[model samples]
Target: MIRKNYNSLLITHILDGNFTYVKNGKHTTAHKGDTVILDCYNPHEYYTENGFESIWIHVSGSNSYELFEEIEKSNGTLIKCKDIHYVEKLLFRIYDSIKGDTPPSELRISVDIYKLFAELLNFQTTKSLGENNYEDTVQQIKEYISDHLSENLTVNELAMAAHMSASHFSRIFKQQTGFSPYDYVLIFRLNRAKFLLKNTDLSVSTVAYKTGFNSESNFIYFFTENVGISPGKFRKLKF
Candidate 1:
């Protein structure tokens, strides 16, 4: 049994066996390939029936506390890693770098730690999106969007393609792609208009229709607002 309260974060990846972790008096079981993240300031405890093999690291200073809080809010204290081998490799790299004869600077170690946290956050996001096939699903949706670039798309239509509710699809889409579906559609249409303007002899009005805008005026307004120039002026530029 181990318990403590401090201003650091502890992340442990379980490689073998099982253990029970307690946070705020709630007991959770962690098995192989599971990871336990603890904000040391939150009194917690963990113990194994027999014995378990694990790799862990303690991080503090800088934005470590803020990062931990964000991750905890998204994934809670106990997380199931998508790839335990990758997590182990990262932890081992940090360990070896520090234990070697020529130890790296603190910045190098901090960067690796940040990368580890990123991977954890990614896993959490992917898990929330769906099972392991979520990436394939999102890719398929993107392809559908591309293939229908000349049509006015709606959240209901896109959600039907994704087999999810509009609100759920919108939430996960932004989490995965950093843009809402409407914003993504708008950006895609803008890029297609730019391509037609730059690479083809299509007129501005033709480009507007081909890219799904309702009128030449709307397309010009949007293009000028986002690209900082009118489409005609944009096409006239040589470099």
Candidate 2:
């Protein structure tokens, strides 16, 4: 069907059958387990030869444009998800929140949308780098960040640890690891939070405190934004 421009990010997850998604003067077929992340600012259309089922979420936020740009640059708008099962769960959770009696707060929605964007980027990074190579400097940077996720980390500080200027270090780091220092730090902290949530019976507050968030609320917010669910919900669903 012809879809008018949306002032938001539009995501479509195909569960069954296939749909043709057109954008930017090009079109692609999205099959079962395929995901299409498109900027609604552009005119787009979806057509199906047969009836199809899909989950769609429209998101708008400060980070939406950047995430959309990143995805477009690296993997274009279509994401053949590496983990469809996990993606399905996230989509269902978003769907539930939208369809619930008490609609979820905007914070909740933004977080879920960011989480989905992160997943797409992570998958693209993984796919673009099929081989594994970790240098000592890269490993050391990761270790330091992981060890001090509870502390405020700055580019200068991380660059100092690597014995390089901030700009130079950032350039090489992104080239080597497929993530900027800032993005890497966030991913590391989020991963650590996930581990703690899965392994410990700690309260959300405690997890937040341990994961470097100044307050429980902040931690929960960041976690929800990155993981697409509250810390409690992630713990329950994952564990």
The TM-score leader among the candidates is 1
Give the per-residue lDDT of model 1 (tens digit) for 15-67.
Answer: 89977676764445577888888888777866554479988888887687777
Q: After superposition, how far is residue 70 of candidate 2 from its true place, in Å?
A: 0.4
Q: In candidate 2, what are the lDDT values of residues 127-171, reduced to their tens digit?
A: 434222234476568668767777888889999998989998898
Give the whole-model CA lDDT for all candidates, comma-separated: 0.79, 0.76
Assess every candidate by TM-score.
0.52, 0.52
- Give the winner by lDDT: 1
